[model samples]
Target chain A: MSKSNNVYKDAFNRCLRLLDETKSLPSEPELGTLLGVSRTTVRSILARMEETGLIDWNKRNKTVLRAPRSEDFFPEEETDSLAEIIERSFMRRLLAGGAEAGMQINELELAREIGVGTTSVREFLIRFSRFGLIEKRRNSHWVLKGFTRAFALELTEIREIFELRSAAAFAALPEDSAVWADLDRLELEHRQLASEIATRFNEFSELDERFHRLIHRASHNRFIVDFYDVIAMIFHYHYQWNKAEERQRNEVAIQEHLAYIAALKSRDPGKVDAACRKHLKSARQTLLTSIPEGRQMQPA
Target chain B: MSKSNNVYKDAFNRCLRLLDETKSLPSEPELGTLLGVSRTTVRSILARMEETGLIDWNKRNKTVLRAPRSEDFFPEEETDSLAEIIERSFMRRLLAGGAEAGMQINELELAREIGVGTTSVREFLIRFSRFGLIEKRRNSHWVLKGFTRAFALELTEIREIFELRSAAAFAALPEDSAVWADLDRLELEHRQLASEIATRFNEFSELDERFHRLIHRASHNRFIVDFYDVIAMIFHYHYQWNKAEERQRNEVAIQEHLAYIAALKSRDPGKVDAACRKHLKSARQTLLTSIPEGRQMQPA
Candidate 1:
């Protein structure tokens, strides 16, 4: 198949939510601006809505027939782009075992197995190569450098370095900088999550990423900001595959984040460093413990 | 054309040097092993050598007829892989001016200009995106982020962080570690280049990369190791574009590197940090100064 219609599908899902607040859809141009798509894409969205009897469209008029049901929205999986699909498939194979170090990755075979073209597979591999889990060979296929303890250690090593520097930078931000406001909001979220830990602990992963990302952004360095993608990807998969003790792990993390946030608010580098170090140390341990026993390398 | 015959051309050049050492060519398998190519490639190299009158071959025996001349080797440009060619072409466009931030990059237009397939251009963009100099728009083309002062500052910020950590790690490595030996070798090269600074200052860029990379490798973190690519790319162009006081600047840098190397050998974290920071600060200043005046941003 060609590139997935994820843009349209995802936009269509968001448009359905907008319909609940009004009887008639706004003008096409307004809707186009609201949905952040071109006029052509907006028209396609309207056509799909009309076909499903969710709206009545005429050149400039679109009337919502009723509230959209759950079925009206595209499946969550279908809304993901082809690159995301390939990455998920590839990562699953990587974390599911049998993907050993130095194993050759065949581009054509992976494309066929994923039911996508080789170009898409090749592009995905190129993009994913940044995570350091796979490598391209000269005049040959890619290689799988297994997700071993060494990989985790190396990842956290950089994460700690970056996050610490970012945290210090965050603390040094002027009082009026917008990041202070963002820190306030995240602090509140951490408290809420901590209070509702029994039921909302699973949600900490997303909040955790946002909190760290906010701190990383304060460094005002694109490389530091971009480096988060690697940390986020590893944690994304780490959270998915290693679910054991996740709630407890997240609970402890929430408290650490609260302290970390408070330390940043204090605008003292020492407190920020200590708070960031404490949280990162625990995080490094959590990641280290998740690596499979067989793949764990002895510490140097 | 498909992938350039770079692998063959480069291997052929290396083979020429080997032919000078021996009167007769080695067995095909032995030649393949030595050149790090397959037997097929080895045979092809032999065929080219014989056809060019550099060697006489008959069944099991192949004898060198005459020393290979300069004309026997492929042009230096012809030996660069398609990706390298495309990157050089693209970076030239980026650094040559008129590449404003927020400008859309047309893959087809770039491919046409570079005389390569769109696939190669697309792959290059995907790979280059990690450098944060360009961004991919959803369902559209890549956007040039421009090589502005902001970009330079952001780059050097991470460079300082990673290098400082790496230097400390280098100092901490046990005496038996192979990296200490590597560091010693680089130190000797640095001294050799320093003594010949008048004629060899131009070569300092390559040695600078090697010395820093050796320190980075000690971090044993692939992310830290791989990050040197961004630093190298920017400096590679910076050295080419900004040549004012070139010899003097490299002379000072050579001295800084010597001091840094001495600190690493001393194996003291305090000394290492001081030496690394001193060198990195000068490097950062050099990079910041190289960014065009128009693209430089006021300090926030």
Candidate 2:
């Protein structure tokens, strides 16, 4: 709104961009000097970032927890929008405590707790309503819907079809396409994640989404791109349902991803299909185990 | 709602079901005796059915024009649901006159013409809003969006991938699955359509949807099933955009469908893939041609 405000916003964005290169933040005095801002202005921006869980500011230093994602690029505000903030908060809540079937979600309480307008929450809820993930009650409240094993199996079957097609298409893509360069970078990332699987296994979910989406994009099909959203939402969020074997599963998955990446690099249709199916089998098993035993059904 | 109303409703449902077996309705006096209702009740029900385009009652005979579909199973009224009726009406309008991008849609005027409340129309509009097919304007009005050639080509590419995977899966399915029965029935229908293609070319769209959906369902993938709705909606509705070559395209599509069916029946993965791709190529061509030439673009 003012020249000083613009200066701080730009600095905050620069700091977020820097997280992509380094996990540690510079000291407050050093950052203020680098950003050409006063220490007080730097502190205000850090506090906003801390509030949204983007970074952790300790007595001694600040650490990057998560980098700014495309969805976080808000022009009007230097911080996350109310929509994005609410979504992250709800996801964290769902992961911490599993939802029960037909569990009623109090809309008013959620709005009050998030300190966002009820209208925003209602619109968010309505958007998800189309996915059968949540249902709006007659009284204007919402109820959570739990996925059955059958549902996951059905989704996995579709995901396999989608990925196999995408993998084949990726292998067939021209060598000059930009996706080849991205594949190289993703392969390096997969290898890096594999090396640290013992400590950072939880980060595999985000990497897995990125890897599959990269392959899917090679097809250049809008339908697959749009539908992949549903697949990603369900698989990524529901990964929190059963965390007992998460580390072991993540290790296996990382290895599978390496195989998948190698197959794509080979650019052989037969080999790509084999590798894609192999990785999908592991994914299916992990998805099955992720569902609670009582809720799990026999493999469809 | 009343005894007489219930009787008339039952008779109307019975008449609709009977259309599956016969294309002609019995005389009113004979229908009254068969339904065990007075001639007056039969006449009232017939009038309602006629109003909904389910039948054509003339001076001497009543002919079954179209059978009742699931969307038309509204009990309290013989007509289609407000949502579907309005959707059909708007689609017809858009097809007859192409939608220009950013053309503002008056919600109140549409609701008035469709004999439905604004809320119903708004809900319907919101569902399609996610696809970028329509947009809710800042002033609470709506605007129409048109598909570019790139959009159709992208859809066709994804459709090809989906059907190819589905066909392969269908070929590998156990011989005892219910899909085999549907395939058998669909094959017969395809043959029937093929035999009469010269006269009944316009009916191919319905059968094409059924044939593709059967293959898609064989994979038992919920995401594919859900995403297929968008694919079907765009390809099916936009077919009306250019009717110049409609008959020829339908004839070719019918023939391709038959070959695709035979490939599936052979249970050979190679054959299935070849046949599926062949049909999809033709479908892509038809889709490209269906868009006005001025709107067509080089395939990505």
Candidate 3:
């Protein structure tokens, strides 16, 4: 698969949603604009729709035949880009608890396992190495540094430093800065999530990332903004690996976020600092508790 | 062409320095231990030395023939790893004033230009992306973010944050920690360089990196420790690009480092904070001034 055809597949899925809202498709150029794709892609989608009898195509006219059924849509996994596929596979192995520190990671083996080219595996490793979980050995393979307690501590340590500074910066943003409105939006989401925490707890992982990322962006420092990737990855995996008490944990976190948002809105650095620290401290604890005791020992 | 033979060439260069002080080569095992290579590599070194008449080799015995000439060593460029060579080449283009912000970087073109495999070039870009000077566009090429004023400011902002925290951590380290000895050794080197500032100012760039890196390591956070790479790269290229007041600037930086070192020794947080801020402020100013005014405009 050259480039995975994810762009076409994902766009086709989105185009199905559009079909449900209209009697007939718009002009090819207009549909291309709406789908954020090229004319070629739009034509391809129309061709596929006509072939599947989902639409009747007669020059300049595309009439919907029926609403797209669940079976009519492409499989959910087919729409993921190759990089995302590789990342999900790689992270699964890493967080699966069998990965040991100092284990050599073979690009060839990973490529074979993932059914992708070596170049893609190599590129994925290079990109993933920034998380500090894997490192390239000189003239050799990459080494797994393991997701140990020390790794969690190191990650949270930087996260706290960055988030604390960013929180203060967020509080100091000018009244007219667009981020205040963003904070308000996030604040509303936090409230909504808090009310439905019992059922919607799983969704907090993503919201947590966006909320912290917004504050980090306030620093207007690319490095600070970029460092969120590390925190996000760890939490993304942590949330998946340790599901026990997740609902309660997320519920408490939602409340903390509301407080944190209120502090940012108050534009009081002291309150922001306190709220941010309170939330981060609990987050660090949650991450630390998730690592298995056996894996927590320092690597020899 | 395969793996660059840099490990062997660089090791051979170090072996020559060892040969200069010894009459006969040590046992192959001993030589391997000292050179941090396998016996296979040690044998290759012996074979090359014997072929070049730099040594006389007999079974189980090898003797130095004459002092290794300058030509006996590999070319300085040949001793660099492929990644280093690619980075230098890439940065030269980036800092050469022709690389516009938002310009696309083609890996295949870069590989051909640098006379390396595309894999190496791709890997270098992935590693370099963490510095925030470049970003990978979805499903396409990497885009140059440029070394503009915003880049410098953002870099120094995190550098200051990380370094201050690390400096405080360094001061709080127990007396038994190994960093105290390292600091003393660096201080001695700083003093030596200070005395020879007129002639040795160029060397301060390397020392500056080591000094700051030592402090960064004290944080015991890999993210903080790894972040020094960004600061180091910017300064490495910045030092090469800006030549005005090089000697005087290094002289002042050396004094600031000494004061910073002294404050760390005193374990006075207030003094350390003041010294670190003072040095960083000047350092930031120096970096900001180096970017040509024309390149500092925000990308439209």
DockQ of each: 0.85, 0.26, 0.80
Stretches of candidate 1 off by over 4 Å are A69-71, A294-300, B292-300
Best by lDDT: 3
| lDDT per residue as tens, model 1, A1-300 | 445678899889999999999999998889888988877888899999999999999977899998999999999888888888899898878777778898999999999999989999999999999999899977778998888888888888788888888898888888889988888888888888889999988898999899889999987888888889989998888888788888899988988888998898888899999999999999999888877576732211
For candidate 3, the docking band is high
TM-score of chain B of 2: 0.69
Worst 10 residues of 2 chain B by lDDT: B291-300
Residue-level lDDT tens digits of model 2 in A78-111 = 4454556678677666555556667788878888
TM-scores of all models?
Answer: 0.93, 0.59, 0.93
**DockQ leaderboard ranking:** 1, 3, 2
RMSD of 1: 3.2
Evaluate residue A274 in candidate 3 and report its C-alpha lDDT on the 0 to 100 scale: 97
Badly placed stretches (over 4 Å) of model 2 are A1-146, A168-199, A255-278, A292-300, B1-82, B85-122, B129-146, B168-199, B255-275, B292-300
For candidate 1, list the clashing residue pairs, or say none. Answer: none
* Candidates 1 and 3 compared by TM-score, better number: 1
How many residue pairs clash in all the candidates, one count each?
A: 0, 0, 0
Worst 10 residues of 3 chain A by lDDT: A291-300
Candidate 3 stretches with Cα past 4 Å from truth are A1-3, A27-39, A58-60, A292-300, B1-3, B36-38, B293-300
Candidate 1's displacement at residue B25, Å, is 1.6
Q: Chain A alone, model 3, TM-score?
A: 0.93
| Candidate 1 chain A weakest lDDT stretch, 10 residues | A291-300
- The weakest ten consecutive residues by lDDT in model 2 chain A span A1-10
Candidate 3 achieves a global lDDT of: 0.88
